[model samples]
Target: MNLKNTMLKITTVVAVVISFIACEDDFATVGSSVIGEPGFNASLYDDAMISAHSYDLPAVQTNNLPLNLLGVYRDEVFGTQEASILSNLLLTSENPSFGTEPVVDSVVLAIPYFSREVLEDDEVVYALDSIYGSSPFKLSVYESNYFLNTFDPETNFEQAQRYYSNLEPQIMSNINPDVLYETESFEPSAEERTEYIVDGSGVTDTVTMAPALRLKLNNNFFQNKILDKAGTASLLNQSNFKNYFRGLYLKADEVSNGGTMMLLNLLHSDAGITIYYKTKVVDATDLDDDDDFEELIEVRRSYTLKFGGVRVNTFEQEVPQFEGENLFLKGGEGSMAVIELFSGPDANNDGISDELEFLRDNDWLINEANLEFFVNRDYTTGTNLNEAERLYLYDLNNNSILADYILENVGQPNSTSSAANRLHLQPLTRDENGNGVKYRIRVTNHIDELLNRDSTNVKLGLVVTQNVNLISTYRVLPSANPEVQRVPGGALLTPEGTVLYGPNAEDEDKRLKLKIYYTEPKN
Candidate 1:
């Protein structure tokens, strides 16, 4: 008889028949898990747990049971899973105070201090919503070149048979003498995969995490922009990927402490290196809109890094690095010199400062020929191209002046293309990652606390005249007792635990979940 999960109601599960030959001495100690049968309090996460069981049905009609038996068995298995799932599941609900008035920038304080709780909810929702699944492409992420390749129909179907053999009666018999089963594996054809590809589910917010990603992005911070992960440094230096910025939808109704992270793509062409900022759409309507879903990129901003050729393109070469704790712009070619931006009140400043200050303050902006006989630091009296008296402008010897690379042409290329693939819950495929990348702004309780402070301030700009090191400096004052926690209805997985899941195929954009609620200007 067919048994639906709803029909099972509160009926206890029937025990399966035994098949294993057992001896009294063979009654191996039934590994006691100390579960359900005892008084121990057990905390089970129904959705996150994976379970599997095997047992023989002593009441089988015959070894050669009718095909219908297979269908019945599958249904029974499904219902059992459903019951277990429903035990701890929470249904979705709307808050009573959800006014269309639009929360905007006006936020409220969260009681009991929790940001991780909020982040957990966001992750759980994302997993349930089908976020971050398998890649559309079958390749690993390519920092340079990457592509997705699947089999042709003939080849795909040819390989599919290998799965069917596992479904045969003989195979099922091996599993259990009374075994009668059905197979449930239907993959899309190549044409179907390419044509009817619907992927890119937004990240869910029904999960919980610990060590709460205080910097994790939220639902509406920076309009869900993804940052370019890497930028090429001039002169063969390994590009720094994580140092860039990433904007995210922040979750913060009330201020506390939390944050988000994002990836970036830094490209290096022979002429120069270009940085692009990218984002994805997470509109509430998109959820209800079940149209041809594809992860699309929303372009943000781009910057070109200006660094002298790796080997001192000019008379002098300077490479930037950190020493004795503080970072300094070192490694110049022709001359060994030091450049300092701020001197008097520059305790927190770097070595390279503004170009304007050198000319006006230190009188070092003149051309090299004029520095009294153009003597190199090596004491080499050289015949400079300038006059016997005039100085060479843009000198590299000044320890206080920073040289600026004036951008002549900032070309905004029209290299637009749609991201066609779904990131379902399988191994994360590399197709979702594109050469084009960006830095998105992300927010959480951390910023709210920042906005609350009187001396709270931050700046976004290049460190020197030359566009290098996109600095996002937050002039933060340390707190003795930092109050950072998860959001309400959210849990901090122990030891930085995560309750995240993705479909074998789902939304391609890997989600960095935010917890605070937000709405667009028009609602």
Candidate 2:
């Protein structure tokens, strides 16, 4: 058989395959117009075959299991987001060392704040990535007097061991003063400490360190809660201690308009509460003096307590756009936006959308399929918080992720032939103005499957890229290994929100579109 004969036979097989793949609908009559007659030039096929449209969908639920506190952030465009944290504290040692005649000196709470980046080169560089705004905001710490049970007593199972973001705080208000400490004139700033390395001769090199929020907590609170429970059963075991003293709730007070929010690293080793106390010890130098064998010395020691058990960060967001024609997209379970792609008027009346119906019958092979999203800079740019750099698009039905995310995770190629096997999400890009402008995602395989294969056209979700997965290596797919899925949600610990041009937008180009570039095979 010659090359032309072989090509003719291949096209015949493909046509038979399409018959088996495409549903029996009115689109069958237009089959010849789909792929065109034999002996077609590939170069003639360009954007002529490509058809694009968009539709606005409802918002979906966000899995807001954050690792750190998001604090209180108020944006003119996105509105207000006030976050509070609830955590169970853990002791450093089994039986803490509070020596003889332990006297409480002072109790301090240290929370390490994180900037987006750290400068390596010298000369006072300000890499203000995290912690937007500098205005003053109040923070209050309270004791969670009530017991936060791990599991339900009725059913002794781990399945019931869960705390939601909406759980009410069981504070110690019954006591005279429930407030542990409250600071109104508090300022959170990065501390640059100069450290010198003294090896053999003298000072060698100097290093600078980031600063933390060091608040002097009420000494009486620790003196009663920790120092008092020295050798008791409460201090001996962690569970007992948690039951005896529930935990702490850090609440952020809202400022009028221009106040800033800090991104706290709660899991950092330096972020914790330290109780300073003095213990009596034997004086070794005074041993020579028979009368002065033991001396009352102000021996300062500290026991650090950190968040070990379940820590839940809650968010209260207000997006005014939801009231109008706009679609609101925010991170954390507080708020999220969904997308219904390739849906609207089925112009061809073939039981499928005009674009899908057109592509269904067309014999052209898709080269590239790009889904572009424009930013709503009209409102978002005016706000203090900038637009989110990246957005994660996933299957709305499963809440697990699209084939694109999975294929990207496994390092597989996404092409028209592999359309049955892969769907690749788009990487984030910035405009020349150094701001997030548009997001162009590639979903060639996804579109190919929808057009030629028997696959469900499930709605897709758009959310902050950070909310998808903290550990980049881990993938949220059942097809993925057990270890990858076990990583769990890292939580949305930052107070950030973004507004995007939805399909319902009045502007045509700004609206989301599924653009395809295709070419007809040589006959």
Candidate 3:
């Protein structure tokens, strides 16, 4: 079958593994074999090397059904008389007509890295596939309730979620324990099982990976401009425009030459990993010929190729880098900060963007940005909201730019008045977590930047923000009496005396806690 048939869209080849990685690091040779060249001459009469390749590529079954879906399924099967029906899909397909036992050798699901977005009329939805090709699936918007509040629907899972699956027994020979699933299902939370997740009966399986990305970049135009620079991060300033005209340098170093082009690399999170293949002759006559072979081919016996994942960028605690925060414009005149972000010709051929390399080369000075937006309590009134709009359009570059990038049709609380359109911001107080932190992006603002990138720096700026994550926010225990409710919404979030982690006022995966003087959106 074609690749699109499977999940992750990875081809199951009886072929050697293929990893996507990036440029490498210095290597050390522990021992050396000294070959004495005593006028040694060896030559083949009629040199020829031919090979055949093929193999039964392994399948990726769900190892752990999925943490979030486990919760989803548990919630799905609630109040049903035969909860065992929840396990129906987990059962392998026996002959559909004969009514066979349908005991599958195994079943598996991908790990849950995404959460569902609730839709109109209370529909729970998730991405069916990926927005970016590098990712396996994208946004799958669906109804929230299989049976919300006494409502039940027939033929679940089909309407619940959409993903790829493989079932051929022969093809699943060597399964990836990390990606494999136990082919099991369970029920809702109860006194007995808090999360309703039963531990896997099988021992934890280890995963094997290779890191190496194949890279390719070709641009004859503007070769002179890029000619101004050259080399990997280590080769710094060596790949000048002159040598580029001469050619023969690593492709990554070539693009960093300062031209407008995207590059990719096969980045291996691990080092010294290589992809190897086992070969067999497609024609038996070649094996028996003994003389110069006639028919020989290298057929892949396993699609389990070993390439690598991109090595994560690492930075010291003191490095000058931009940090992220959530901005919830409740409004007043305040300052906002902006930090520069960059990208480079990728060393990996995974065909994704690379940014960390640019920072290291630029003395860690990222693109310029700041966190100083005005906070207006209610735009429905007067000058307060307009003042916040003024700073959002801070013309530091003086490019005659409007804050439109800030308040565009951002898939969220769109502005209602013409005044909301012209608001700008300046920083009042940035809770500097010391090492390096910045900004207060409204959660609405942050996610919007992540989704769209064409016009503003919101998405483009993420190259530097990738390492930055918004920490969890807790709406501190609020007091009931009116006397206790008089604190600022933002004040209640960060207890004045205590310190928070990671530079941003909030911790990982959460931030920009809004203290509501008005109605808060229901989560």
Candidate 4:
């Protein structure tokens, strides 16, 4: 059925169901009078046929994302994943003129990490967020020659060009042989950086900035490319500059047993390359002298090239094929679970399963439906391991949010609480020691529609999400499964993962199952 018709039917049924619930005091009598019965009895049904399997995702589209991931992350359950970034630099202004005899001093590239300021012992300190691992990793920066097009030429310049996570090999092949910057061992620090700046008069001033990945780039590269090309066709505008210099490729390599992974905010205003140069300027102080002699002195000046235009994230992941009883869910070209509900024999040659047909044949009013995923603590228990805060469930066929999620998030206040949309997508439960327990997701509306309305029973996709509110999806280039062309965008932003008990889990009590509460009129 069309989505509009389905939504209208769902809305009308929900309104009727809500009205019936509002007058619950007379529901039993009303139901009894209509059916010539005594009353209605509510019961819990936990046994329902469900099947779930894990699918390893192919390289997904990763261009022009809000944030980018860099470094290597190794998980005991899902193996290792290495992330890198390639971006085009843009001038702050067009057709810039450098004063005569402009000499390059130094060039620095800075990218901020997700962090927040906190007070510790009455002293303000910065705390890094969304950073994984502790060991150092090797980081290398190279000048890329690959041109990232804003529009796809194959599509007659009508569609945006897409870059996938597996483009590292292609990008590396197109880079300059000489590395721009490299570090044998690099790790993110939470401590604020203090810089001492000196003016033309040799007066030093101290400046404090937030924590960021600051590195000194090859001065000759910027000097020859930027300073030497001032007012030339190459530096005339952003378009010409991008075609001239292309971009930079930040590559990460494993240096130790474990490597650090950090989410970088490259779009920040301060995140870019700054070129410090010396220019000759007339000394005003000397002009006021009695001799009225104007002397030229070398003054320090700086020009910044911000990261703009097209930016793409490249990932190299080693995810093994799933073969276990438990399901593994990892983000960023990792893995996801495909869930099937009410899987049983359809003896009548109908689409609806016999088990679901039985529930429909009996006039049962569904009150609640929940799918609980128990965490396999044995695999996820570690001091250094980080688990996903929430898991998102959606219709895999349509690539849309479930009805329950839409209903629960309606009119939700815009607050900072992590517990938002708790009714439908509950956050991961934790123990007293902060270990993960399980995630219970409500799908009452979805299940009701499947049984009471003409809504199709579609397969559900489950994945780890950074935020529950971000329901947008991004296309998965060369999708692993034909049915799954796209996955949740929030899932691609996170590197965290978890192993959950699947339908065929060895532990009967912990096996994933749908629990439904319903009321039926007593005969």
TM-score of each: 0.14, 0.73, 0.18, 0.87
**Candidate 2 per-residue lDDT over residues 242-307, each given as its tens digit:** 887777777776766655666666778777887766666565456345577567544556678886
- Poorly placed runs, candidate 1 (over 4 Å): 1-195, 198-365, 368-523
Which one is best on lDDT?
Answer: 4
Q: Flag clash pairs in model 2.
A: 34-361, 34-362, 35-363, 65-491, 66-491, 191-211, 404-423, 404-424
**How do all the candidates rank in terms of TM-score, highest first?**
4, 2, 3, 1
lDDT of 3 at 354: 37
How many clashes (backbone atoms < 3 Å, residues ≥3 apart in a chain or on different chains) does model 3 have?
130
lDDT of 3 by residue, 1-523 (tens): 3312321122221111111011111111111011112332111110001111111111111111211011110001011000000111110111111111111221112121222344556854432211111211111111111111111145443443211112112112322222211211221111111111111221223442221111111222212112212222211322221122221111101111111111111122221111112233344445455664655544322111111111111000111122333222211001122222222234575432233222122221111112222222222122211111122222223222223334432332334333333212222232342221222332223222322332333211111010011111111123342111111112111101111112133342322222101111122
Candidate 4 clashing pairs, residues 3+ apart or interchain? none
* Pairwise lDDT winner, candidates 2 and 3: 2
219-245, model 1: which lDDT tens digit per residue? Answer: 232122112112222112322111221
RMSD of each predicted structure? 38.8, 10.3, 32.9, 6.7
Off by over 4 Å in 3: 1-155, 162-302, 305-434, 437-523
Residue-pair clashes, model 1: 90
lDDT of 4 at 504: 82
TM-score, candidate number 3: 0.18
